[model samples]
Target chain A: MAENPTPTPARPRDAAIGTGLGRVLLLVYGIFALSASARALVQISSHFSEAPLAYLLSGFAGLVYIAATVGLAIGGERGRILALVSCSIELLGVLVVGTLSIADAVAFPDDTVWSHYGSGYGYVPLVLPFIGLWWLWRNRPRP
Target chain B: MNGPLSLATIVVALVLGVWYVIRCALNKAPSNTDLWSMLGLGLLVVVLVVVAIVGLFGPDRPADWTTFVGYLITTIAFAPVGVYLARLEPTRWGLLILAVAALTLPVLVLRLQQIAEVTSG
Candidate 1:
């Protein structure tokens, strides 16, 4: 197979953060960003009182996803910091929320993106953060 | 929202998704044929969405019509977005992106079907 040479100029090492596999990651992150935010919007608008805590968490998750997506899209030192922070928060949120949702069902009357390790969304939420972090780590500037 | 149409779309997407995954594993970029097949699947989704919109005006309409319409829009745009992103990255990962999009379509369709099933009118 002939090598598919990339025509884009190779400069600003940070550009690598949004190419190749990173682009695939961007697509997944974008999907999550849209779905999470939209879900939160619908939930909050239609029935905020039903599960305020869960709904708020849903909104927070949506913002985190949006931040991560933007960070990946931007792809530079600033973007890396943004992505790193959000991914860390996401990882913590999923683990904490997942465990709490299982241990104390009463508190979580309704589900958020992180609830039950995102079983409702096929656990993609649980796994996405790890992937995001790995991608960030892989793209980190070398000494 | 026709059962047969949804089933066909799901099957096609799953098949294409599998093929894309295999190609990615083999380190192959998305070929024109792959992209065209995805566009064809996108066309099928559009038909399905149009049928769903027509169904909304029929006797039985979804109780949460707004959410149903939202899913319809998302479902219809999914394939083209996948194709566009895949075009940007011409590598094995592009195939993976296509695979993800194809696989996600079935889930979206299933959700649409679920919403359609719960009728208020």
Candidate 2:
């Protein structure tokens, strides 16, 4: 039995954030970015007076999602830091906003992406930040 | 948007989305057939969108035309975009990407229906 011998070109295992499962994360983040931003734009532009706090929160959430998406896609030291900060903030934002939105309905008459633990988005928003953080931690630079 | 065509699109997308996810769970990267099925779903969505666009000119249009059109454009473009990204990553995760895209389509279509229901009364 002769074993076939051929030089298999070694592909560089660049531990970028936007590779493998990270690519799937990027896609999900991209979808949230578009959706959150578009929803914020519509809410703020059409009726900012209706729910100023909710609309502003929506806008902020959108920016955070956008930052995370960009950071993951870029995947450098700076990008990792950016993604870390944004994802942390995102986790905090969803937790605080989700609780507040439910505890006090008057303040959040309109729903943001983080409202009620992202129930409007099938709770994906609530879970995304955690995933983002895990991905970052998994791909952390070695000493 | 509340027609049989849109319903069919939603059903097809859900079925394909589940199939893709199952395949991914079984550790299968998306094959050509899988990708092509997605493209076929994209074409169906296009037909649904075109029908909605034609209906837009008729009376009793939705009050929020801009948002309606925005969702329409998103729905039409989503599947192909998924196919493109999945092609770039030929792994189980790529199949998950298509799965996510397919699942999101039903939500988008439902949202379109909701927006379209708001006629100027």
Candidate 3:
């Protein structure tokens, strides 16, 4: 595509902590971080005993989002590794959780972020990990 | 959420979504005016959230008051967050952020309505 002719000045390799695109991803990741964590906070505070499994899963998803945000915000070798691992886990989490939620409804009495491919959140949670992974892959250190 | 205010926010958001998508099609970053327009939309959202907050005092208050509050915070913050991110890129992606936020607002509003529907009464 003729779009995006100018490469971002801040290359991911150099670990320039903040680029425009990084800023954008930070916003999105930040939102997810806030939402997931907030969801967990509310769920746990009101009724932790209702469904410990679902509540814990929601908190885990929030942590992954927070990790991804920090990784993208940090932007270096370590950051890359952090982002890579978190996004990979996120992908697996979403796929497995989505399937499990559908296959066995009794287990998931309430919704986690990844339940049913994040259908509750319009599947953005499902798609976000893929995009996060792609961005990290694109910016991976060259051999 | 089921009120005119929520509907207005959703409709405005959708219209803005289309506008931003068109701007992206043209490969243009958000201009100063665009940012201002976003801020204006943010004002509208603020009003909507305020109204929703007032609704909380009514006897029809939803059972899930805490979750309703959570959505209120998110809805109000949405536009400014978009503006902040859009300012950073100065490219089509900036507009895309706006587009994403605009599209997401409707969902947030819907969620608010859903939570509010399960009232204690």
The per-prediction i-RMS, to one decimal, reads: 3.4, 6.6, 5.8
Q: What tens-digit string does per-residue lDDT give for candidate 1 at A1-143?
A: 44558787644455434468777788889899999999999999999999999999999999999999888677678888888899999999999999999999999999898999999889999999999888878778888
List the candidate 2 regions with Cα displacement exceeding 4 Å: A1-18
Task: Sort every candidate by TM-score, greatest first.
Answer: 1, 2, 3
- Better model by TM-score: candidate 1 vs candidate 2: 1
Give the higher-DockQ candidate: 1 or 3. 1
Order candidates by lDDT, high to low. 1, 2, 3
Report the C-alpha lDDT of model 3 over A40-112, residue by residue, as the tens digit: 9999999999999999999999999999888877878888889889989899999999999999999999999
For B1-121, candidate 1 gives per-residue lDDT tens digits of 7999999999999999999999999999899999999999999999999999999999999998888999999999999999998887789998999999999999999989998999997
Q: After superposition, how far is residue B112 of candidate 2 from its true place, in Å?
A: 0.5
TM-score of 3: 0.90
- TM-scores of the candidates in the order shown: 0.92, 0.91, 0.90
lDDT string for model 3 (B3-110, tens) is: 887888889889998899899889999988778878888999998888788879888998988889989998999999889878767888788789878888888888
**Candidate 1 Cα errors over 4 Å, as ranges:** A1-12, A15-17
TM-score of 2: 0.91
- Clashes (candidate 2): 0
Clashing pairs in 1: none
- Candidate 2 on A1-143: residue-level lDDT in tens? 13338855542232344366877888899999999999999989998999999999999999999999988777677788888999999999999999999999999899999999999899999999999998888778788
